[model samples]
Target chain A: MRLLLVEDEKELSRAIKSMLVLSGYEVIQAFDGEEALALIENNFYDGIISDIMMPKMDGITLLKTIRKKNIDTPVLLLTANGQVEDKVEGLDAGANDYLSKPFAFKELLARVRSMIKHYSPIGENTHISYGSIKLSIATYELAGKESSIMLSNKEGKILSLFLKNPTQIIPFEKLVSFMSCLDAKDKEIELYTSILNNKLDAVNANFKLAKLNKGYKVASL
Target chain B: MSIYGDRLAQLEAIVEKGKTLIQEIINEEVKTSGISPIEHFKYRIKCEESLINKLNLRCLPVTMESIYTNIHDLVGFRIICSYTSGVRTVANKIISNENIDIILSKDYIKHPKPNGYRSLHLIVKLKDSDVPFEIQLRTIAMDSWASLEHQLKYKREIKHKDLIVAELKMCADEMSSTDLTMQAIYDLIKEEN
Candidate 1:
C-alpha cells in the first residue's frame, strides 16, 4: 500500500515513514499540508496521514480542500488535542479516521490498515487471502493450499484488486485503468481471464472469475 | 498532451451532447403532444480508468482506436419513467426524429434476466457524432430493483449472502409485476377521464 505521511516534525516524520516502510507500505513524506497538496497533484496514494498541527495549511483546511475537490482517498488525522469536539470537527470536515498523538505505533498501524480496507479498491492490501487462496503483493505470488508460484506483474496487480474487494463487480474500465492496459476488448478480457483461470486451477485455487454487468467479479466456485 | 486526454475530452463532449439532445427531445415531445413521457434521467461519462477497463474487458485493445469504437458505454445514461409504457413512449419519441439512428435496441423488460434484472437498452448515434452512446430505459420499480441488487451483491462480506441474493431476486420479480399493475391502473384512470 502507498501512503502520504504529512508532519512538520522532521524526526517524527522520519520515525513514522521508516516504521510504515518496515511494515511494507510505500511512504511519501510531506512537511505540511502545503507540500501534501503539491505531492497529491502529481501522485495517488491509497491513504493519507496528516497531523493537525503543521507549518502551513492546517490539516482541517487541507481536509476540506481535498473533499471539496471530491477526492475520496481515505484520510486519518493526527492531533495533539484529543477532545471530542476536535474529532467531531475533523469528521465534519471529511476525515475518515482520527488518532491522538503520543500514541502507540500499533494503534497507528491498525488505523491505517482499517482505512485501507475501507477504501479497498485502491489495492492497499499487500496480502490477500480468500478461501484457500493466498496472494502476496510483495512476492508477486498466488498460492493455494497445495502449491505456489510466481505471478506476472499484470496478473499480480489484477489479482490484488480482486482480492481486495472479492464481492464487488470490477467494471471493465476499472480493470483497464488499474492494470494500465494499452489496449483491450471484452473478448480479450475473456481470453485473459480464461488464461488466468487455468493457472488458478493449476494452483488448486477454489475460485474462478464471474461475469457481471459488463465487468468481472471473483467468487468462490 | 496526456496519453488519454483526447479520448477523455471526447467522451465528456459526447455525454454533454447526449444530455442536451435528451432534454431537447423531451421538450419537443411535451410541446407537440402536451404529455411528457420521460420522468427523469441521468447521464455520465465513464472515467478514464473505468473506460480503459471496459475496453480491455470487451477484449478490445485499450488504445485510442478502441476507446470510441469498442467501448460503447463510455458515454451512457439511464432514463427513468413512472410507468412501464412510459419507458417505450419516451424511447420512441427520442429516436423517431429523422436525425437520430437507433443502432441497436434490446427489450430486457419483456425478457428479464435470470436474476430478474429488467431494463430496455438502446445504443443511439446522433447525426453528427460517429461514436454511439448507450441509453437504458426503465420504470421506477425496475430502477429500485437494480440499485438494491447492486448494493446487496457488492457487499459479499454480509451474512446470509445466499439468502439475501435469493430474496433480492424474488423482490425484483415482485417489483416487475408492480410496475405492470401500476401501469394498468394508470391506463384505467385515463380511460375513465
Candidate 2:
C-alpha cells in the first residue's frame, strides 16, 4: 500500500515513514499540508495520514479542501492535543479516523490497516471483473470463461491493481513500492508479471498484463 | 509436524487470558445489573488443521505472518444470553471496557443476516497483545437456531435444500419473536417484585 504522511515535524515524520516502510507500506513524506496536497493532486494513495498542526496549511483545512474537490481518499488525522473537540473537528472535516499524538506505533499501524481495509472499494467486495475474467480478492482465485487458477498473494495484489486501473499504465516504481519486499527489485516484479501472464494463459483470460515503456497495463487478448 | 505448533500454543494461552478477562467483565456487569446477563460462555483457539484449511481456502501462504495479518479470530468467544436484552447488555459491557480495543462491531441482531441469523459480533484486541480475537453474543434462542442452521449448511447434498432453507428462516423468525416475549415476561416479573 502507498500512503502520504503529512507531518510538520521532520524527525517524527522520518521515524514514522521508516516504520511504515518496514511494515510493507510505501510512504511519501510531506513536511506540510500544502506539499501533501500537491502530491495528492498528482498521485493516488491508498490512504493519507496527516498531523493536525502544520505550517503552510492545517490538516483540517486540507481535509476540507480535498473533500470539496470530491476526493474520497481515506484520511487519518494525527493531533498533538487529545481534546474531544479536535477529534470532532477532524471527523467533521472528512477525516476517516484520528489518533492522538502520544500513541503507540502499534496502535497507529493497526488503525491505518483498519481504515484502509474498511475504505477500499475492492475491500468491500469478494469479486471484481475485468473483461471476461473474474477475480476473487478474498480467495485469490482468477476465473475465466473456461477455467480458473489460484494465485499467490503478491500475484493477486498485482492483478487486483491492474484490474482496478484497467486503462492506465501502472508505473513499475509504484508496483514495486507496494510489494511486501523492502528491497524489491525490478527483476522480481518481472518474474511476478511472467507468472501472472502464465496464469492468465492457463485460465484463458481474455485480458493480459501488457508491458509498456516503464510500466504495465491490462490489454485485451 | 505442523509449522504452527508454537503459534497454536501461544494462541491457546491468549484464549485462556481472554476467557478470564471476559469472565471478569461479565461478573462486574452482574454486580451492577443485579443479575448475570450472560447465560453461559464458551471459548476456543482455532485448531491447526482448521487454520491451515482457512489459509489454503483464502490462497494465503501458510505462514505465521499471514496468520497474524489475515486472520482475526485465532481466539473466539461465544456468549449465550437468556434474553435478547441480555445479549445487548453483555455486548455493551464488553464494548465499554477500557482494557480492550474494539476493532470492529457488527450488530446482526438489529439487521440480521439474509438467512435470518441474529448475533452481535465484535473483533477486539487486548491492551497487552497485538493479536485480535472475536466475540459473538447471541440470545439462547438465536444460538439454538444458528447451531442447527450451521449443521444443515455443512450437510452435503441435502434433499430439498431450498425448502429446508425457507423453513429454517421461518423457524429463526419464530425463535426471535419468542425471545422478545420471554424478555417482556422477565421485565414484567421484575416490575411486580
Candidate 3:
C-alpha cells in the first residue's frame, strides 16, 4: 500500500516513515500541508495521514480543499489541540478520520489497513475461487459445482486466505497468524487445524497432507 | 475595515439605542400581536456571555456578536434545547411571527459531512430591525459534543495511540445519532400535547 504522510516534526515523521516502510508500504512524506497538497495532485496515494498544524496551510483547510476537489481518498488527520470546537470544525470540514498526536504505531497501522480494505477494488474475481471450490468473500459462503454450504465465521475466513493463494503451501505459522483469536497452546492449535481440515473436507476442497510441517499447503484437486 | 473599529462601532450603536429600540418594538409587538412584552433583554445578554465564556471565545471581537435582535435593532441569541427537535421547535416558534423575516439558514443536520455532524442555523429579522444578526439554536448535547470535539480532535494533534481513527469516527456517529434520537422523543412529546 502507498501512503502519504504530512507532518512537520522531523524526528516523528522520519520514525513513522521508516516504520511504515518496514511494514512493507511505500510512504511519501511531506513536511507541511502545502507540500502535501502539491504532491497529492501529482501522485496517486492509497491513503493520506496529515498533521493539523503546519505552515502555509492547516490540516483542516487541506482536508476541506481536497474534499471540494472531490477526492474521496480517506484522510486521517493528526492534531495537538484537543478541544471540542476544534473537533467539531474538523468534522464539519470533512475529515474522514481524526487522530491526536502521541499515538501508537500499531493503532495507526490498523486504521490505515481498515481504510484501504474498505476502499480497495477487486480487479477480477468478485468471488475468490480455488480449484473446484469458490468462496464468496462478499457473502461469506463456500460454493461448489453441485452444492453450496454456508460457512461458519471462522471457516469462512480460513477459506478466504486459502482462496487468495490457491495451489500454494500455507505455512502453519502463517495460518495461525491469520486466525486472530487463536491461542498458542499446542492442544488448541491442533484442534484448530483439525477443525480447518474437517471443514475443507466437508466442502470437498482441493487438499494435501499436513507433511509434518509447521503449516499446511493447498494441493491440486 | 479594521476589526476593532468595525466591531466598536456596532457595539456603540447597539448600546446607544438598545433601550429605546427595545421599548418601541415591544410596544409595537404588543399592539399588533397582543402578546405580553415580557422582553428580557438581559436574558439575551446573559446567554451571549455564557456562550462566549463556555466556548472560550475571547479571541472574538468585542462587538455585538451573539446579539438579541428581537428587541434591539441588532439582536443575537442562542437557543439551547434539551433535544435536537428543540432546535426546530424554537425555530418554528420564532418564524411564526409574521413580523419576522428569515435572511439566511443552514441545515447541517440533514446533510452532515462524512465526519458526522448536525446542527440548524437561522437568521431572522425581528419586527423592526433593518439589519439582521445571528441566532444559533442547537441541542445542549450537540453543543456539548461540538465543544468537546473541537478541543479533543480539531484543535491539535491527539496523542492517544490506543483508539484508532475508525473508532473515533464510530463514537462521533453514535453521539450524533443520539442527539437526533433525543430530539425525536421531544417531537413525540410535543405531538401528545
Among the numbered candidates, top TM-score falls to 2
lDDT for residue A206 in candidate 2, whole number 0-100 = 79
Error of 2 at A75 (Å): 62
DockQ of each: 0.01, 0.01, 0.01
Please estimate how well model 1 matches the true structure, expressed as its whole-model Cα lDDT: 0.75
Name model 3 segments beyond 4 Å from true: A1-221, B1-76, B153-155, B159-169, B183-193
Candidates ranked, most accurate by TM-score first? 2, 1, 3
Q: Chain B TM-score per candidate, please.
A: 0.88, 0.93, 0.53
| Candidate 1 residue B129 C-alpha distance from true site, Å | 1.6
> What is the per-residue lDDT of model 2 for residues B1-193, given as tens digits with 9 covering 90 to 100?
5555666667777788878877897778778877888889998878888888999999999878999999998889999998877887778877887888999999777656767787999999887788999999998998999999998899888999889887787577557655654665576566658
Better of 1 and 2 by TM-score: 2
- Across A12-108, the per-residue lDDT of candidate 2 in tens digits comes to 9999999999999999999998998887765667789999889989999999988675556799999876578889999998899999988899999
Query: How well is each residue in B1-193 modelled by candidate 3, as lDDT tens digits?
Result: 4333355455444444544544554566567746422323321333344544543544543444433232232345545566554456456756665666888787765444444444676665545546565566666655665667666665456566346454544454456544544444444444556
TM-score of each: 0.44, 0.46, 0.31
What tens-digit string does per-residue lDDT give for candidate 1 at B1-193?
5445756677677778778877887888789867667888998776767776676677888677777667667678999887877887888876787777899998776556667688999998888778788999998888988998887777757898678766776576556645654564566556557
Candidate 1 wrong stretches, greater than 4 Å: A1-221, B1-3, B158-161
- TM-score result, candidate 1: 0.44
Please tell me the TM-score of chain B in candidate 1 relative to the true structure's chain B: 0.88
Docking quality tier of model 1: incorrect
